[model samples]
Target: MKFLAILILLLNILSAQNNIGIDSLQNNTGIKNNLSELRTELDDIFNDPNFSNAFWGVSIQSLKTGETFYKLNPDKLFKPASLIKLFTSSNALLLLGSRYQYRTEFFIDGNISNGILNGNLFIIGSGDPTIMIEDTFEHWLDSLNHKGIFSIKGNIIIDDRNFRQDKYGAGWLAEYMEDWFAPTTGAFCLNKNAIEIKIEPTKIHQSAQISFNTEFIENYEVINHVITSTKNSAVEVKINRIGNNIIDLIGKIPVTTEPYSVYIPVNNASQYFLNSFYEFLLDEGVEITGNAVKLDEYDKNYDFNNTIPLFTHKSEQLTKIVSEINKKSDNLLAEQLLKTIGFEIYGYGSTSNGIKAVKELKQGMGINPNNFIMADGSGLSSYNLLTPKQVVNLLAYMYRSSEFDSFYKSLAIAGYDGTLLDRMKGTKAENNFRGKSSFLENTRGLAGYIKSADGEPLALALIVNNFLVPSQLANYIQDKVCNRLANFTRN
Candidate 1:
């Protein structure tokens, strides 16, 4: 009887093991079927007639399971546009740390006596791009007043040698050279090196009032051709810059239209910096006995080792600046950061050195150099080329980095803030999807992170190039992809 009972017990145990195996197999099959469905839907979406002629380079990977969910020409090179800012921001975070600060120092070649400076005031720029007329210059004037030095007897020299004098990115369109988005970069930068032009319609058949946003004086000449039209007329305005600071306003504005503003790139950022500071100094009752001159034009030179330090200005931390680059797509700031990385790593603040620094950082992250070509830190350059797979791979790598929190938070959140504020609204992707958006004439890209319905983290890169369709159509496709991914579940 005991042997028979033991035999039955062994058989029961074997039966239970077989049943467990069957259940596990069934679950695996279900998962495969679900993934297959996901792929089919995505394929149909991308195969839409509107995108039939466009190239869609897409890559999506599971951050939790290390699984590639989908890929469409993932290894093909495409113009990443502003999406290149992702790489630039990541390189900065790794090389400079999130807490890194840019410092601009004030030095003197002479002594201060009887409320007067008897020598030149040398301002050395360490590529602090965020200096503002109100925030930085005002405080500086106050500090000068506190020190009892209200008058200067020597020249105000700008030592702008920290960065190369490359004003424009290579491969930028010639037509956009004077646009606000194409502002020149220099070691000594203020107010992003751009000026805002505010236009308001007065009366019908009258000229529109064009004014500068900042109170500081500028030399740009505006030949106003824009006329106020009927109250119901559509607002049509055009701006043209010719012969160094001459701007032509050629269009019409309706009398009922609200104030319209556009930002224009300054002619000379270094000179503009000086002009702004000079205006501020004069406004604060400070007397100057010498002209403001850049070091390149100044005939006299002084040894840096013998100069006495006066005051120093520090910028917001790197993380805040990175937020400006990715979220707001600030081209000038991005360029400044690229040059800064070069200065910090290679002892020169040139675009070439910055590219080298980024390449080195990418290699450290195990990204293949052959997969992409980086022309500039800001995606404003059409010379930048990247593969979707490589971008997603980079995102995955960042996800595992210690600075992931800072990097992730820098991206624009869909329907909430930054560049993606109006996109993906009223969908599952809203507030869940975070990414960086880029647009050139014919290119659109979105790259960043999202969490699936099952709570699985994902990194995605979707780039559309060579499309003749309107940009809204391209945006629709990208937003749809985000919504689909945001609702994806493997459970």
Candidate 2:
């Protein structure tokens, strides 16, 4: 009787195994069918009449199974615009580590006797771009006051040898110089290398009152020709920076218009830093007997390494800095980070060296070198190109990296914050998709990670170029595709 029971149990076990096999086969087939439908739907959307002249490159793959769900010219290269921040931020975080911090130091070349310094004060910059007027300058001045350094008998010197002097990136347009987004970069950067101008109308026919931040008042010359017109008139303002420090504001603002503000990029970032800091010292009652000087202009061969620093200002961690770069899409911060990486890896802070470091990083990440061209740290350059598959591959690789937490948290979540704050709302993809948004004239891109309804994580890259229609139409199509992916399930 015991032998009979054992045989019966074996027969039941065989039946259960057969049932599980059938169910697995059915589930696999269902997944295949759903993927096919997804492809067809995406094809229809890409083929819409509005995008007839546009070049679309898309790649979507499962992060869990490494399966490609869809591809359209996945190997074709397209200008990634600001989406290139994904690569820039990732490379920086991995190589520099999330805990890395930039140090800007102050040194004295001579001895201090009594309450006066007998030598020059040197400020050596390490490319901390987030330094603001009140936050940094005020604190440093207080330190000087507390230390009883009331007078300096020598000049204020700027030691900016940490990075190359090239302020603008390669391939940047000359027209973008006046815009805040195209600010010049340098080791000694101040106020993001730009100044904010606010315009308010005092009367219907009077020149608009133009005001700016006090830190730059002595550094720039403004020619305001704005006229306050009728309440119903359209607001048209044109800001142009002619020559080095002269800003021309020409336009008309309606009486009923709200206060208008614009940020204009500053020329000669190093000089701006020098003049601003010099004035701050004077205002704080610290007398300077000599003029402010740039070390490169005065003595190019000065050795900054031998001097002991008086005080050092350290930047926030790389994690927080990377968050600012990716989330806000800050071009200046991105460029600064690239140069910093170059300095750390190649012993130089030039853009060329930075590009070399980026190339090396891509090789380490197992990405093909021939797949993309990286011309600048920020995607503002038209020369930058990336393939959709390469972007998706990068996303997948980062997902498995130990640095994934910092990198992931830096991305803007759909409908939540950063550039993606207003995107993909009121849908399953809202708050579920974490990605970077890119935009340039006639170009748009979205790249990052999302999860399917079945809880399958996916990495996707969608890029559109040469589109003649309004950019909103392209956004519509991208949003639709994300919604479809979010609602997809194989059960």
lDDT of 1 at 147: 71
> How many clashes (backbone N, Cα, C below 3 Å) per candidate?
0, 0
Task: Give the C-alpha miss distance for residue 53 in model 2, angstroms.
Answer: 1.3
Model 1 segments more than 4 A misplaced: 1-33, 213-219, 256-259, 299-301
Tens-digit lDDT track of model 2 for 1-491: 98897667566544433443243211232343377888997898799886897899999999999999999999999999998889889999989999999988889878777999888888888888888887899988877766667899999998777788665678888888778898788787788888788999879889999887755454578999999999989888998878867889999999988999888877777888898899888888889999999987878988766665698888899999899888889999898888898888987777778888888879866678777798888799999998999899889989999999999999999889999887776667878889899999999999989998888999999999999766766776787788778878866
How many backbone overlaps does candidate 1 show? Answer: 0
Q: What is the lDDT of candidate 1?
A: 0.84
Return the lDDT, model 2, position 443: 96
Cα displacement (angstroms), candidate 1, residue 108, comes to 1.3
TM-score of each: 0.90, 0.90
Q: Cα deviation in Å at residue 52, candidate 1?
A: 0.9
